[model samples]
Target: MSAPPATSPSLVLAHPTLAERKHTWTLTQPEWGTALTLEEYLHREEYLTTVPLAKHGGVTHWILTVASAPPDQRPILSSCETLRKRALYSTTAPPGGGGVAEGIAHGVGSVFTDPAYRGKGYASRMLTMVADELKAHQGTLMSPSATAASSAADDKRLPPVAFSFLFSDIGKKFYASRGWVPHPSSHLSFTTLPSRRSSTASSDAAAAAPPPVAAIGYHELAELCTRDESLLRDRMSRLPSSLEAHQAPSSFASTPPDASRPLTYVALAPDLDTMLWHLMREDFITTRLFGTTPSVRGAVFGHPGRRVWAVWTRTYQAAPPAISANTLYILRLVVEDESAGEEYLAEGLRAVIDLAREEAAEWGTAKVLLWNPDGEVEGLMRRSGLTFEAVEREKDSILSLMWYGDGPGENVVWVAGEKYTWC
Candidate 1:
């Protein structure tokens, strides 16, 4: 169907307040699909209402509706949530050793259009409205001094949205038409077949290996929340600088061998406090939504001496192609000390994989999926005897990582370590 007239003043963009949450919830239920139970929906609603981030303005949800419809018929046409964050973007410096340049980014997710309203351009209109809102907000934050020159400089120095991003189910072309580009990254999937060999052989080989020297332990979110803040803070502070790089600006001259080149990459760099808050909030919501059943759990894994950590949650797969009935999604995996080397991170990952396999066996599923695994971790997983297969084209769900505003799309590479998606 053709889009509604572009100039129609009857269209309304709104951010529903707490008083209108019930109405908003009802509108969203259809978008969430019939797979989610009413109890699950109520759990999500409660979590959204209580999360500290919402109160602090770190997140906001938006909706679009027709202004002329009667109060009961003013159905929400499209909806999405925006996460405000200072994502880290980096580019290699010119040859003589200037470090990577860094900048902030904004993350968007959970975009949905009412099924009955699809093909009418509601989603596109809502996206445009959200982009405008973000652009204006970024302008205010980047230029508190508010000088014309500063504003002009901000326009040139930053992308139209500073940095806008979303994971698209609609494929690259759909988003590309709206000026968003796919992130340069790869997601890896691995499957472990159930062992048919007898338990005695497996037990005997394990007894022969020197007591599995690496110390691996899992702690629930409740326990992690009580751990000393200084530990996590120090770990976050010590992460590598290259992990966060900005795209190179167009004006920079090509540096010869002597000048340091710019490092180009996209990353989310939440501080220790923010990271902790995310863990607690995610745990609160997922536990209630998925329940305390054996199929799901929210926890963190730590290696010997607490030198490395990874956060993850195991739950039943709800998305399509049925790759597996159960899956473990890694939220963030970090090495507090880079000097620990790939082997160290590899060992931590292997432990997590082992745990996942054990859970999968118990849950009767055969595969594990990792979204947007970066080169380093991907290499380690391969080295640890895990093989990857790209989701078959016919079965693929079109997981497109699209970005908008500022910097050339080619200069940015989205890595998986810092960001977390509940699904």
Candidate 2:
């Protein structure tokens, strides 16, 4: 009889500890880029030591390695991270009329495989392991309160998490094969700035026209969070109800039978303390990336009581035309004055854009990209004299928002005005 074929090398999943941080950092550098040095990365970790997500079991990190790899070769094959947060789901019941559920949202980023190990199925096996971990952790996520718990238990008896989501730059079909479906409810828009000559002319004419009164002012992210915690929370709490009535039905809507209701939705539920910590962390990253002082990259505009905030970041889209330059990204936008309606929100957005434009000019970029803005917000962008074009969905390498879960996965929307770039 022929000798039995040698068994294939098994892959092992492990979490990097403090001792292995350098190794982990080495694996991520090529994918995350050279702007962030190992020292800066370590500093960021030290600064976020108290961030609520990690403290409360809200985030987890993992790495995969080939158990049988030779000692001389690097064993780490791939890595990813997940974040857990309290996601709110709307209900028809009274008393605030919404319920809070925990979501172990899988970010699944920094998925890099060693070049020598590519085509050997390491990435695929690692993703399968991630899916298994998410499924196992689903039951452990908690409901917000006794009431929400009862409501969730009474409904579909769904898993603790409504869904796990990831923003995939990789091909959609690649993730699809791993059981992730593109979120049809979300889309991206890109706006090109008017020529520099026209913009400069307009600025000079406005300057000559009048000594304009500053009705709206802009402040740093930390200061806004400090001064407007309650207002921010109150405004954030209402986003789900507002979107349910206003946003058009997503093409991907399935389940719920009701076309109007979202299949899955999320808002930033960070408490006052958590928000401050998050902003500080962002400031650190901004300073490192732009060589500007902390908090200079983001601003909150409008009156303190009725405010809008926008954070800026540099991004590169490596699609057609191959842009590898600075592109201003609206990292987060929020309108605090709910009763003021879309027009007021539009005005606030415009003010923030003006500030962003100044910064963009300084950085020598003429392109701006806005993440998933609801229908009302997009309309406001159009009315403000900015022409926006939808980014075509790609089978692979589109900014794919894919989710996995039983509860309204297709209908889930992002309501929290803030976007976590680190996540």
Please name the candidate that would achieve the greatest TM-score relative to the true structure: 2
Worst 10 residues of 1 by lDDT: 250-259
**What lDDT tens digits, residue by residue, belong to model 2 across residues 1-423?**
111112234666655444444566665665664345767766665455446554444455566754554322425666666665444444334565655444434445566665655666667778778777676443222222211112212433334554455656665667767766664434344544333334545747755432111322224445654544445444444544443464455433223324564434455443433444455555565566555533346556567667776666644322213334546666666666656766667666776666666555555455666656766777777676655675644542333334454444445555543344335
- Candidate 1 C-alpha lDDT tens digits along 1-423: 333443467777665444344455666666552335556665566465344433344456666766665444456777777765555444333464323333445566667775677777878888888776666444221111221112222444543344667656555566656656544333566565453223436658655342122322233433343342333334333333342332223211112111232223445543443444454554544455445434233222455344444454444434223435555555555444456667766665676555555444544455656665545666777777666685422112333333453334544444433335322
Residue 196, model 2: lDDT of 38
In order of appearance, the predictions have TM-scores of 0.66, 0.67
* TM-score: model 2 vs. ground truth: 0.67
Please identify model 2 stretches exceeding 4 Å from their true place: 1-10, 18-21, 34-59, 66-74, 91-97, 101-104, 135-162, 184-247, 251-262, 270-294, 314-324, 338-343, 363-366, 392-408, 416-418
Which candidate number maximizes lDDT?
Answer: 2
